[model samples]
Target: MNDQPLDNLDGDRDHATAGSGHDGEDHLRAPAPRVDGYAPLRSYAAIGDGRTVALIAEDGRIDWYPTPDLHSPPAFAAVLDEEDGGQVDLAPVDEYRMRRAYVVGTNVLVTTFVTATGTVRVTDSLNTGVAGRLPWSELGRRVEGVEGEVSMAWRVAPGTMFGERSPWVEHSPHGPVLRAGCVTVAVPTLGEMTTVAQEQDISGVFTTSPGSRHLVGLAATHDEPVHVPVPEDVDAGIDRTIANWRVWSREFHYDGPWGKAVQRSALALKLLIQSATGSVAAAATTSLPESWAGGKNWDYRYSWHRDTAHTVDALFGFGLREETHAAISWTLRTLRNPDMQVFYELDGSEPRPPRELDLPGWRGVGPVVDGNPAARQLQLGVYGDVMGVVRTYVDHGHLLDAETARTLAALADAACDAWRRPDSGMWELPELRHYTTSKLGCWQALRCAAHLAEEGHLPASPDRWAAEAERIRAWVERECWSPELQAYVMYPGSDSLDTSILLHAHSGFDRTERMSTTIDALRRELGHGPHLYRYTGMREEEGAFVACGFWGVAALAQVGRTEEARQWMDELLETANDVGIWTEMIDPGTGEFLGNLPQALSHLALIEAATALGSGLEGR
Candidate 1:
């Protein structure tokens, strides 16, 4: 095996040994295990048309995508299932090294493969319409040979709905039309390519010589009265889609270290936003699992009030005022019950009950779930999440309507009543513990309410709210703090450290000394190198929560430990796949990514931590 670095294998290089090694005598042997699953995370870049998104690997494989809509069933689900699940692969047939990147300021992925014959750049994207509507949408692939000839093979397989069963397909001159109940896929092809309909998928082959260019489009839609756009129209659609994303990205105010990662996070947030209702999902895919067959998988596609509020606050920091305002409105409208629920569907519908599916989950994690039962749990922290958004908007010069003010006042009163009760904390654990963080979260709500009233933004009894906030704070100190441990425990009567307390600084419940002490204690107990887990003694169960690690970074920066904070932040960034994407968690021992990936919580924390670090450096 050649020991040369893969990055050195580029277009101008010669005699590069970049691909996985294969033996001539074992020509029928299966491929070797990739350095990473499918391909290195670094080899992939994401592209989206706001409605749907696709991840194109450096090797030109569309390994992960939710077609038709961000929340729809995936057309390429290989990111989770690898072998059994389907993927749309368009890569060189020979040993070729690949380089990939997103077009600047847009969610357009471009991957260039350099081979002994020639170099070919393949651009992949889901087409979008003028008004941000996806009309006759298709996954467009444009291949341009930059140097030498490369033989490329294309395969499109729609996996069983979340690994249920393979769909049926039919071939046509326009392309293959794949049907799976309500869903249909239309692919556009050229005359040179040969299309074959297999048992469950359609496969095609096309070879581009030097200086030749070709286009292929995969369109998916429901059973409705719609005219499928022509191949030329789809090509134009790709151009429009790129322009749309570029225009949207220009709205971002961030210009800092890790600019590309932040932009990708912002774009991902945009893609998860339900345009019609303005509700943003926590992620596009659910049940991708926190650990393989670990029973830790949970659905994240639903909108959690806490998650969306955090999203709005993060977007507000990036000068995305429109999205912030829309998200706030959606949140307020969705939680109209006065007693806010933790999660809701994109259209503000009530969340369905949590029930496990009979089918195997991603990577054989059994019993994949749809709806989240966390919605029904009593998470007192939701009041704080709501108040956080409202107060942030008010502080940022966004005027609050009378209804919003009334809601805040009512919510503050509710928090005052609920703060004394023991409930699930931010982690949504089944056991109802007297979580210090949950109590503090309620305290934050009341404190922020008092501030809003003091600032004349809301009608609230400031004195009463302040008194209640003080009581909650005192209770947390008396019951939740463990003086011997020199840190706040996960809950009263428990010595276990929790990363959730890292938010004490951001929540204004604690200053540098208290937060710093808690940080050091958590590091001692839960830190796997620089990545912090949610709690100690849960090694056999949960993976290291990705957001918790970022929370520690933010906490460190808040306490004037900027150097250590930056170091931790860089370490967290290193955990991201090649494309700078993170899952919900990481394996504490090995640092292998776990959970449904491209998690919004992890990205939201990244934005907040980066903003904190960036602001701190600017002050110096």
Candidate 2:
């Protein structure tokens, strides 16, 4: 209900006038600019309906939206390829200035455009049906006239499945329906509107006066018959969607120092949770670029086992038992594969083998990808991630089912055998090495398994787990520690340092002198003004990893540097875009977001960092 400023919410001044125009309103009539046919990642805000997410640019262009699911091939992929990739644009015809906010406490977005002639407000949402998600996906946009009269233009253009399939409009009894591959979309409009269906897009223009309203909706389905939405029903659905989000938000109770940021993070995470299967995707989009220099982009639309414990802890902090239970159950059910692949598809299947797309990437970055390559890699640390989550559930006075207990025991036994092997560490790099953090992860997993067995929640060899855990710790101390750098190396006998080791600070790893000293060393070697690269030597390759910066915050708090952690947390909070959504990385020098957006790890880390600081203060 509160109208937070679109800019300068933190008291910073914006030079651009709200609705200002140069040359007597001529310049203000220009459409929002795009560089090389793309908006800055920071300019996009996400709207979703539990199953899929759409990214709307500040300019009122929906540049990215996948069909039935977040991981499906996108219908509007202008975020990746502007020319061939399609977009849906609805903005004033004349020059205008805009400001937007998430209708306060909801993912529903309201953007107000101020033009020379008049002002209008656009409300955007992915409509949800009553009792949960609808059988099909619906995207609704409502426009209301605020004052005077404004001329507005709109278009609905679905893409070629990232240059894979061609889309065409089929005139049906229900109006114009777009078909691409197995996906079908219905375009519906109201309030004196008639659209022209072209080869690949549908567009129309309308004028709005004071107190007038217009509506546009896209109802779509993959591999199913599409339902054409009624404009009045779509308008009502938008309001209902807003209400649903607000109701969910009310249940999330957090009153910490960064309460607003944490709340926004929770809502962002909510969008990434797939309601159908309870799997939490790592992000909403694929191949958004981790570095403008290109070559590092990877699809993050799949769920990673490594994020299980963090997601559960973050959800638990807000008393969201539904999401917490969903994440735990999904992880347990998916890991039954026994291979424990690093990540899985939302439908609990192995990811499609990664393949290069024919389309150009965001900002001309090439080799756009469709799937993640790390799914097959050996990530030894997953043992800890899985066991740690189950242990947390058990510690909350919940008993694990017999099947889950047996799975945990098997995972613990696997960890004991795998601790000595060199594999991809937490970073999922290509190189296999005796990563110090991977060793620490195994040690943490065994410790959790031991505790679970003692509580009768897991059937396992507690004595063997305890003895092996100590041996792993001793091995890490003897081999992974670097006397030359006075810190834990990335791997045994390597000079590089990894911020991933910071995670163990919360895993009950050593908080004594050596670990504390490594924190300072990491800050000196890898830190960039409260941000951090993933590891040593990454500064030249990519931006600072957003999650690592938050991990540093949690690490500082856990290592007993509360004041320093608070200061770092404050600075890091400002790094997010105006709406508090984060991508995988941040360009430290430019302060622009990079990589797939609304990242689960980054938001989860923020929650963990905030909670750590709060708990640290209470213990004092």
Candidate 3:
């Protein structure tokens, strides 16, 4: 809320102050590596203010930021199109080696740059207001000199929405402002520096001496009067944001295996949870290709019922009532309509059909999609997703309203009827067939419904649900198990194996000798190194799905192979990027990131796997 109009922005903007010195040196004399002007996905770290996230590369470039909200159009998106996409660069002018990490317990990033002349530290954050989230978004960069004097250069450039709209700079009484579409941005500088205003950007250079501190603030708004933040207030907000994140992180109660990684995953999931609503975005970005040859890109900013359920379950493990309740309540309220889609918009509305945008995609992976087509598919697993979370909610000593109870009963009845039909399954494949995982999900749904009815939380007939669950069990056992392969196949008759079957271990569906044997078959067929391809033919097209590997950890623990699960967990934890962020997939051979980043499902799976190992409890 430290934003005011141009009339109030007149002041001596020199707000330099000496701050604590940073320790650590990662030295390299070479320039940052780039291929076609794009940094490697593994080279990026993230900082956010709960409303939206900004991806910052190790070299100090603010790339791939969506304004106002996570799903909104980008205000800075050099990660996608490099040339036309906007970016904010703050780094040493000369060649420097850099290393970065989240400031211990918070999302605020600290990157230390070591040059031949001296060293400097850049602390970056999307500032939060005093009360809570701010109405206007502010990107704060605090530069501190740790050693001898070093020269630094910065640029604040707003893009044309990848040629969708044009950006122009307007000179005002206070300074130069960049306007593109509905977004208006003001770059305010503090400390000893010189700045130049051009047609499209504001450029600057400054020299920092030992103990000198400087700040660069970008205050922006969409469809509203832009606020030019006071440099002093922006500096204070950065400290306040760090304290706030630390306070939130303290409430996370995990002491299991890979505790640091688990907490990082939880923080990453928090970034995807929109504070305005309780909806959880599947990932932070869209159109980051799953395949290098293009055509696999899809938007993940929407909320899927399955993901919400998983998020609720993971939050519940940490005893986080607010997030768990908000997610469940929002999902149940959004699903009041009889027909359920695969996913919904973040604001509890039905999503529009997928549309491909006109832009050179990330590294020229074309057909950058804006919405998702999977919303139209009939994924029967959503039934299990809903019922499972409701059961967990009730188990946690919470009550369901009368309307929700009735609606769930109806959904249970529908699941009974739908399990017999072939549907798109969890993967949302174009060719619908009798997917074994989808059938298992229906079986789980009926079982949970019967349990709820017995506990008096539901009004449905328990007998019918139990009978249907038994029938599903018999059908899956009879047709889905491939005797020759000694494993459960993808469908009734196909010989292909899918790693999604590992999810059944945590679903309370099967943990018998057969299920244990199936785990071995899956690892043998799909695993490469510490990762697993999603299904039979995914190795031919994409990298191994990151979440599937974590699912294996939970499956192994569930089947009583604790030693194997712990060893596997150790190896998988090492696969995360330096900042503990994970993409949708990882190339097993090259260790490169793929697909959308800071993926919620991958982090959620990590939490679940850790909980499974620590508690030694059967899947709920």
Q: Write the per-residue lDDT of candidate 1 for residues 1-620, one digit (tens) a residue.
A: 11111122122111111222221222222222345355533334566665666766656777777766766666567766666556887888888766554555666666667777887777777777888767655788888767656888888887666656568876666545787656788777643777777867878777877667777778788665435567787767767877887777788887665565666677766767777677888876667666555677788878888888889888887888778888889988875674468888877888878877655454456557766778888998888898888888889987887887887788888888998888988989888888888998899889999999999988766999999999998888888888889999988888898888887787878865777898999988888876777887765577778888888888887788888887777777656654455677887676566776567888888777777777666665
Best by TM-score: 2
Tens digits of lDDT, candidate 3, 1-620: 11111111112211111111124342333434778888888777777887898998777888788886787788788888889889999999988877666765677887778888987878888998877789999989999998887999999988877568778899998889988889998887879899999998888999988888899998989999999888988888888998888888788887665666777788889988888788899988988989888899989989998899999889988878888888888889877966788889998889988888888888888768889988989898999999998999999999999999999999999999999889998999999999999999899999999999999999877999999999999999999998899899999879999999999989988888888889889889899988999999999999899999999999989988877887788788767776788889998898888998888999898888888876653332
What is each predicted model's overall lDDT from 0 to 1?
A: 0.73, 0.84, 0.84
Query: Which sections of candidate 1 miss by over 4 Å?
Result: 1-45, 80-84, 163-166, 170-175
User: After superposing candidate 3, which stretches have Cα over 4 Å from the reference?
Assistant: 1-32, 617-620
Error of 3 at 290 (Å): 0.6
Q: How badly does each model clash, as a count of residue pairs?
A: 8, 4, 0
lDDT of 2 at 18: 18
Better of 1 and 3 by lDDT: 3
In the range 409-467, model 2's lDDT, one tens digit per residue, is 88888889999999988988889998998998899999999999998887765999989
Q: Model 1 — which ten-residue stretch has the worst lDDT?
A: 1-10
